[model samples]
Target: MDSLNYLYGFGNEHQTEALTGALPIGQFSPQRCPYNLYAEQFSSTAFTAPRATNRRSWTYRLRPSVAQLGFRAYPLEGLKTAPLNLVTPPDPMRWDPLPLPSEPTDFIHGITTIAVNGNADAQHGVAVHLYVANQSMNSRVFSCADGELLLVPQHGSLHLDTEFGQLQLAPGEIAVIPRGVKFRVQLLDDSSRGYLCENYGAALELPERGPVGANGYANDRDFQYPQAWFEDNDTPHQLITKFAGHCYLTELPFSPFDVVAWTGNSAPYKYDLSRFNVINTVSFDHPDPSIFTVLTSPSDGAGWANLDFVIFPPRWMVAENTFRPPWYHRNVMSELMGLIEGQYDAKQHGFSPGGTSLHNCMTPHGPEAEVFAKASNDTLAPQRYQDTMAFMFESRYRFTPTEWAMQTPLKQSDYANCWNNISKLFDQNDKI
Candidate 1:
């Protein structure tokens, strides 16, 4: 990938050009673009949405997106859609990482849907998927008309070639590919595996800080957007589109990443997890996990999010005479947690890198018996929780497991036993 030149500021209107003076100044959509490039505006929201929340970008490209001759339906292997419901009682579940693909696979081919919520066409809820790829997406570009993809790499590194520019990401990092952005993922290592969230609601934005004051959690300066880069190749390449829960193939005699210069708030961006401005309690109680939210897709209801991308990064623990582990409780939102690296404080074992645990809405989840015992008796001295990174995909709706997710050998059937080992400590409560 070419060295990236970025336009700083998140959700801010910005202009950039790979070639010097290639961007038209002062206005967008000029009658004749510089260098005779075609101009196009990609709108992520309705044109009349609030100015502060509106997202769109102008691209000066050698060819517009319409250059494809036509779109034909392509099979979406094992990909599932919404309205999936199950009648069983909700349970706290855990699963080891899905085995890496035995057969050769690329990013698009390796994705296997684990669960979905809301309707993609209706633009609500989200989809959870696990991807394992041993090969790169060569001679092809992929576009998701369903929603923007929030990619979390758990293994290997990714070099993304997008219509707007190129971005490279590794484990402990994330990339947000805007809805309808065409891009291809290339493996920078031997193989790749990761978590993907298909957000079908409003575009994700930095969460409101609320009472945390002006700072904490993810900061704007920490978010990085790719600078303008374009493909000028006329070689044949395939373009795939995931639209309305189906994949479509489009043959193009040209490359789609042909934007020479572009500017807009609706573009691909990435953020390093290490850069998150972590917030924690300074006094007695543990703050809600929402305080760690990096981004949220809000719904019509206030304070309710269609999806919340929250993380547990290394931070200080200084609460006075309190259990350091997260308190046990049932919550309104469903949570799917994954460990990217190191050990999560809540689980002493079973939850490892690439492993996942699911606690649906109103399902009880917290530290296992061992973790509870450890935190309950440990001295309440100032300590650092270093060498740990975990994250969660929280949704307003409950998650329905896919057939594969249900029957997979990786499923830990004894996951609930972790809590069973907690002995009766209440008998001595009267004496205390």
Candidate 2:
């Protein structure tokens, strides 16, 4: 993949065209579009949604999206969604990385759901999946009507060709494709492994800065959107759509990415995790993990989120007379964590790159015995945490694991034993 140009800003109504005078001057849909192209409105939110949160785009393409043929049921394996039918156990779960495909596997087939929460039909919660692929979607395009996709590459790089344009993504970076946007994923390496979050609730947006003023923690200007680019292929292609926990296939005479120009705020965007300005304590005690949230999808209840995309990036640890690592405590929000590169300070072992761990809502989970002993005895000094990037998909709703996830050999049965060595340290006489 070549070094491609990108449009900056998170939710800006950007206007771009591949050709001159392609977009209408002021109106979205004019009586006649420039160059005899058809105008189509792509909406990700309700028509009557408030102007502040509304997300819609106007595309001028060679042919409208309605030109595609009828869709047929296409049964895809491994992919699953909420509301899951299985009874969810409260046990803590951890798993090794899903191995790469031995045979040819594209982005769609490579996806395997680990856990899910809420319901797709009801438009809430999220689906957590692991994607391991070796091949690219050359003649195939996929769109999800159930939810938007957040891609976090953990192993190799990926080149995405979407209706909006092209984006180059890799580890240490993340990308979000809006719900119902057609796109293709091309591998830039022999094999790729990553985590995918299918957000079924409200679209993810930058969390409110609140007392932090208007800066720090995933600034809006760092978000990179794709510029308008299209292909005019007349050959046959496949459009696979995932709707209501099922897959459907549609045949088309040409590529679905025929939009010559577009103007909208609802489009795919990518952000480098390194750009996140770390906001930590210079005083004492570790702050809440919410401070590291990159994006959030809020639920109906105030202060409660349907899903929060949080990262534990490399930052300086300088809390006077306090434990530098995370403290031991159960949470109301369920957490599904994945390591992108180095060791998460809380769990130095077992949690490797691409591996996953789940601490369901209120389930007892904290630093392992080893991490606990080390952090408790280590001196408190200003230390730069280097070579680590871990992330979590935290949700208000508890996630139910899929059958494949429970039965897979990668599931670590001995994961809970890591805390068995926690000896009783409650010496009442030892208090200073």
Candidate 3:
């Protein structure tokens, strides 16, 4: 794949030695293009070309790309590590297991480390919640104003009653409920369970193919979209909606999930993560982490991203003269990493499945003593990285640490010592 280069700013010509490059623009052609003195009123100009006008709008101008956008791009300070913000910690005292509604309809209930409180501190755009229930019933109706909801099953199977009709969601399967749409989950087996990611922004989109061409990573056809299904049942059904940090229940005469026969670009869908086309370097070095990105919410600024959801799945590692694992570096975006299973290659100790680590914007984090020693001593060869699966919830905003995350007993106390062992590698005679 060719390196990606961008041309920002006006009045400056930038050239990319790489074959793949993008020319950023400040204004659209035909609207803001330089007018020709001797040509007809509609004569085409360099800026008036159809391609130029289509690529950019007249309201904004282009600028050059920088390694980092600088502090002015973000509102918060303390880029390295923002203090944790924990307004509502997990309260087992508040854990109230509600019985399924006695009515013959869909119902959901469970406990979560994070509550469904409407407070800003309690409600993240990506609220992680757990769900469990028994018996199958009619699908219930629910909607989110902020973003889509991802149902990640940890156990059991779910029969989803969606606009696309009845569908079964088994363990390891993920269902996506788009924002503003109504849907319900019914347990196919005796017991059902899972984790939920309530996305509060743009829907998860396919990453651009760029120079990699149409191959590698997730392909568009691999995505499964549900067909339309609508129900005409008329009864007093409650429709619950979450908006602006508050939950509102509205009594409706029929199931809101009923979309009898609607067809459009907007609809709920699901996909198997296993189908993702994993990309890696076979010879010299590891590729950019972005290669593993499943979805990205680009920032208002061009090129830079607001949030990028990257995954580290099991794959082969065959790089030569490379560390094979991720190299150490401070990032501009705050990274919140979570493990689903197996060990992460970067941090060999402390980080475990179900555990989380936050490397706030610009905070340095990498391999611990154990991983470094093993990598330094291991013979270079074609290696297969197996049984490991991890993910990162990276955001442009510096994470305001939750007090619970910082104070929890689960927090590793010896994390700071991971870098202490590196001092042994320094030598005065090695100074250049």
Best by TM-score: 2
Clashing pairs in 2: none
Models sorted by TM-score, best on top = 2, 1, 3
Tens-digit lDDT track for model 2 on 1-432? 448988999999999999999999978889999999999999999999999899999999999988988999998889998997898889999999999999999999999999999999999999999999999999899999999999999998999999999999999999999999999999999999999999999999999988999889999899999889999889789999999899999998898889999998999999999999989999999899999999999999987999999999999999998877889989999999999988999886788899999999999998888888888788987899989999999999999999999999999998988888989988889985
Task: Tell me the lDDT of model 1 at 340.
Answer: 88
The model with the greatest lDDT is 2
Worst 10 residues of 3 by lDDT: 36-45
- Candidate 3 global TM-score: 0.66
Any idea how many clashes model 3 has? 16
Count of backbone clashes for each model? 0, 0, 16
Residue lDDT tens for model 3, 49-120: 354221111111121111111121211111111122445322111111222334332334342332221123
Comparison by lDDT, 1 against 2, better one: 2
- In candidate 1, stretches whose alpha carbon ends up further than 4 angstroms from where it belongs are 1-3, 85-88, 428-431
Would you give me the overall lDDT of model 3? 0.52
All candidates' lDDT scores? 0.88, 0.93, 0.52
TM-score of 1: 0.97
